[model samples]
Target: LPRRGADTPSLAAKRGKIARFYLAHASRANNWDLVDLSAPYIIGRWLLYPDADGKLPDRGILDTLASHSDLWHQRIGIVATLALIRQGQTADTLRIATRLLDHRHDLIHKATGWMLREVGKKDPGCLLEYLESHFRDMPRTALRYAIERLPEPQRLYWLKRQ
Candidate 1:
């Protein structure tokens, strides 16, 4: 059974172990059905321990879970990363968000925008700077999200560019 507390070291270790176990299983598990079981475990563990110190995951570690190319896993990863940013881990999130924007996947594009929107909520000027630089290149959905919280007039102005 999954543990209920986030603060316990033992529980944290257990979650990490579960996540690693599922990740290993995902590598060998051919059925997409089995892959689903690992998805939540991996995402849950990442949510539990976002790398707030800005250390990228080791290459070996990333290789182990490379199967996360699955759309569902990418979506969950994006949501978890955004949740971290919303919780005020802006510096760390900025690193993650920047990398996500380079992803070719459309879902990741939207997720990057979602995180940028939260950053905008904390500092609208910063968002505007990013928008001014990237709006023309960003996916429409992403651009809209990054601008969604702006004042009515500002929102209309950006929307007009669409």
Candidate 2:
């Protein structure tokens, strides 16, 4: 079980240690249920470790973290990556988003779509291109999320394909 410590000067260090412990334990779990239960702690830790300027973990570190054995951890890692992208880390975000779209997990599919939606806000054409190219392969939930915020005509155009 994860510890809930009272706030203190070393709170960050404690949280970091807890996160690492959870991540290590979660990585060894053979059951998906256990992994699912541990994901929140791992994600909470990564979010808390944002850089001084509020940037997310470095791309290399994030990528390595994404390699954990648990699918739930991968999902949370992808969501963290999406959050980073939303915070202006476009290059790394896009790279991870692309890889996540290919993942077998439905949650990963949705997370990738959600990230693409954010990217769409800044570059609709890129999202449109990605949608057109991948729509046939994308899960419906993912496709819907990717196109949800587009203008009515565009949304209808994509939704009609389902």
Candidate 3:
């Protein structure tokens, strides 16, 4: 169970401990809102910080979550990358999206496509490039979500693509 109070820990050690606790308990993290609220702070922030070797955290964390037996964990994997996306980092999102391409869950599809739509918001060209290359195989719900903000003509072009 996560701490649900308004009391903010002022010590670095406490915050670190809390973050670690979140990571350890992620498998038990059920529900979309729970994941959406917690993942960015724990997994996302952890990945943003480089380690002793000056090497960035392994984004394979997302991949691990993507492969979890739990569907909630899978959502955590993708949603956690939201922190990275906020910092203008997108590769992990794209990589995770590719891995979840065949995911059967509507929640997974929505989450993946939401991230891609976010990518489009940041760099439409990049989204266009991705869509051009992979839209054919993208699930319709995901495709619709990803292109929700695109201009009508371009959106139509992609939709009608053979």
In candidate 2, what are the lDDT values of residues 130-157, reduced to their tens digit? 7787787777777888898998998898
Weakest 10 consecutive residues of candidate 1 by summed lDDT: 56-65
Poorly placed runs, candidate 3 (over 4 Å): 1-16, 51-55
Q: Write the per-residue lDDT of candidate 3 for residues 52-108, one digit (tens) a residue.
A: 454566788799999998899899899888888877888998888888888899988
CA-only RMSD, every prediction: 6.0, 5.9, 5.0
Better of 1 and 3 by lDDT: 3
lDDT of 3: 0.81
Look at candidate 3 and tell me the lDDT of residue 114: 90
Clashing residue pairs in candidate 2, if any? Answer: none
Segments of candidate 2 deviating more than 4 angstroms: 1-22, 25-57, 65-67, 160-162
Q: Write the per-residue lDDT of candidate 1 for residues 1-162, one digit (tens) a residue.
A: 234554444545655666556555544544334433444345434554524343323323422233266654444444444434554555544555554555677666676677678888877777788777667767777777778888989988887876
Q: In candidate 2, residue 28 scores what lDDT?
A: 66
Residue 152 lDDT in candidate 3: 95
Best candidate per lDDT, number? 3
Position 140, candidate 3: lDDT: 87
Q: What is the RMSD, in Å, between candidate 1 and the native fold over all Cα?
A: 6.0
